[model samples]
Target: MRSSGVRSASALPCKVPYRIDIADPPDDALDLLIELGALDIEQLAGGLAAILPDSVQPEAVALALRSASITVSPAQGRDNDSVWLLRTAPLRAGGILVVPPGVDAPEGSLRLADSEAFGTGHHPTTALCLEVLAEIIAEDHPSSVLDVGTGSGILALAALLLGVDKATGIDIEPAALEAAAANARLNHLGRRLRLILGGPEAVEGAWPLVVANVLTAPLIEMAPMLVRRLGHRGRLILSGISTTLEAEVRQAYRHVGVNCTASQTRDGWIVLLGQASW
Candidate 1:
């Protein structure tokens, strides 16, 4: 499950929407905005810009970016509708059709919302994970799945739609769990999906299929816990790692006796498939 950002200040009766414009933002500054839950980010000649919700304070965001030496300025307020101008496009991954809510999906397609929880199916990491999941399911059906950092619960929900009997999604953020639950209901898979509000420790039993789409540091840090949650002969699909960190992540899991069986890379992001030898 993905982590949540800091809660915003209490909402006022009326609020003005704003965009935070960063001048000459470095890669680290841009990453900071993403981690802080900036919904829409755009590249600019000067630096970068992000559209934040009305609830978020531009000053607060600027303060945070100060450490990275990025200068943030707030643009004039705009209509809320402009925030979602870039609608999420439908993604066809393997046998799954991931569409945003209210959009028409083909029969058997999975409908998800573009919520704050992440994993809308458009990201390279999520797409790579989906592709890996589809391949594995086609080769051998898995009875159950455990989705770690289940942002938007897309990975776990997709598994159920692809014939997995049941799935459990774990995340450290309540908002993510809420979004995942809503998506499960949207896809009409609520009964077969269980949402948890914690990390790997929140999961009690091992699963035949486990997928975690998280960054390299967290993935490496949770290697032992993740391996423990994988049933014997089970398959583990890990993503949200860059090509440069592939070796480091592989070694981390190898230390726990799991070997990378396959890997797929797209747009510099890589996903690894692993299995433990009994």
Candidate 2:
């Protein structure tokens, strides 16, 4: 799942950018920094360096690095914009078209901009979700959809393009909501998509299809609520779960009487598809 922690980093006042230079950074070190809201990152002579927002105290970052057992030091004056180089290209996931910003979307493609918000269809979680979503549409053709934690509204918008009559997307981060709205307009699905600014609590009624591509912990916590939003015979697609957590996540939904109907895995990430017991 995309962390919302970095959503507001751009709003924080600019202060001295702290650089954390690592010699032989661990494979997961970059993931950890991204999770902790690093503003920018670059490769350096010995290894990699990340520029953290001023709001993130250096001590906190150092502690995180130590916890990961990654060797790092604060390099006081180095700055780089290479982080922005990380961009999403047009992705063909299932029958969906995921086009990055500034790139023209071909016919029937879903246009999304590169922003701090997540879900550019680059992440495996998103790709897995889109695949299952397309399968569901082809099999059941659910009339409506609700996308929880809809980062860039990619899932919801894709559902619309794939023939779902309408879709609703909810996110706790204002930046994500803003990005989703822009993406809806980009795809010309603004009228068919509704962007909400809160979690499931902000949504009303039920949907024939629902998708939540959030992490395992939050997925477990919201299991009941998400299940409740499903209409009779409705389907739920849950992703952003690691393979190790698959059973645990499935049990969470099972506890709420939702049976896992299908599953797909890619790059160690798993997506579980469920349907409420009739």
Candidate 3:
């Protein structure tokens, strides 16, 4: 997340640029650009397109974003507001609709606030995780869930809305936990959603189901701990892994006695479902 009010510390040009391009931006990308006075913004395929004031150079804004690991490329263009004018439509994760906070949403749709944390439902992994989560919940009716690396708490929140009794969201980043907490409240799931500002070790309890949508490496490293925290007949959903690395991640869990019973792939990303092989 951008500091509340940080004076420009990086080298940036003085003239404001008209257009900005961001590739693989974080969840807070849109919020940050909007905060940076972007005239308008649109989601791109694994990127972002933002219209900024042409009066200033793109250097400052670009530098500011790079500090947060988001690259902002200068893409000057003639006024084309019409290009992104019709994107207010909501996105879907399973049967749940994803809309920005305060936007008109059908009942039960997620009204996610703009956040710097991840899991804004823009990524394919997040949507895939939700699709699998919905299916698992529908089939098993698990009462509670543990969401590891719960960025915006979208997964845990969705679990509650999908009929799970309670959810605990864990994230190593404090900012992520904060974002998740706020989102839980936004959807009135705060009371049912517990936010933990640390890794899985911060909490101790076996869960009927656990969902972790973090990247491949962390998932591999945390395989044992996560599997150990599952109750009898527990189910695990692991995502954020690329198709190329699917075998490596699956092997890591299988090494700890997990039998991945199902898997799905989308846009080259993969999600896996596993159970303890007793």
Candidate 4:
């Protein structure tokens, strides 16, 4: 899972009726809009822009925002699918390289078709998680792993490519599950990757390693469930959190019998590493 305070999903197709741009909002405000039901959000040059949910009107979005230098306008629909798909240069994270589907991928490279869902591997939070996973994979040599809120299935797929035998990716969104399946097929790891729709409760058993790169709030909310899903000595990687709230998230997990033994930060985002004791 990426930050709910994402810049926006303009990289993917947008059908939402109205576009709302808020100039230089407080960091938490964009996420509040998402919680209030914004869609296809794109981080604007200076602020943030998001399309109102189908049932939500621009006025409602503005009213909810309560005057934060907002501009509501009609969205200019896209004609070609290729134009909206996110196309970027190869991204390197630890031992992995994220490239567009057709581009050449050297060993340890991932051919990702960036879409509406998160986990493009470009976000600092995602990259930081991957980096930590690479190190953990090297040190622990786990055979299987679980990914919570697996967006593009990047984390799970990367684990398989790095030598994990099987991976289970769970998310609440059907669209995200679809994207993850497509990516698993794209990587030819379909046999090893399992995609499930819903949260961690939907899963049947604990895992040797679990990687969840979602935002701070969900991370905290899911702390107990995440802790319960870990094997006696399993490792946990939590990302997609702002640095400011790291303490809060760490405390949440700590209360559930987990402790942050290590952490990594990049560009105002963070990933916490912990182990389960109970």
Q: Worst lDDT window (10 residues) for model 1?
A: 76-85
User: Candidate 2's residue-wise lDDT over 1-278, tens digit each?
Assistant: 22111112233334655555555555686788898887667777656767676677756765655533233333333112212232355779979878776777668888887777778776788889999999999999899999999988989999999999999999889989898999999778899998889878888899989999988999999998888899998899999899999999989899999988689899999999999786
Top TM-score: which candidate number? 3
* Over 4 Å off, model 4: 1-86
Worst 10 residues of 2 by lDDT: 1-10
lDDT of 1 by residue, 1-278 (tens): 22222323343234544455566555587788777777777777877767666677766676666633333334332111322323466779877998877887688899987777778777788889999999998887999999999978999999998989999999988988999999999989999999989889887888889999988999999999999999989999999999999999999999999999699999999999999776
The TM-score of candidate 1 is 0.71
Greater-TM-score candidate between 3 and 4: 3
User: Number of clashes in model 4?
Assistant: 5
TM-score for candidate 4, please give it.
Answer: 0.70
Cα distance off (Å), candidate 2, residue 255: 0.7
lDDT winner between candidates 1 and 2:
1
Q: Which of 1 and 4 is the better model by TM-score?
A: 1
Model 4 residue 51 lDDT? 60
Point out where model 3 deviates above 4 Å. 1-89
After TM-score superposition, the amount by which residue 176's alpha carbon in candidate 1 deviates from its true location, in angstroms, is: 0.4
Tens-place lDDT per residue, model 3, 24-120, is: 5666767878778776688878788776765544566656565343434444321112122213336898788888877877889987776567776
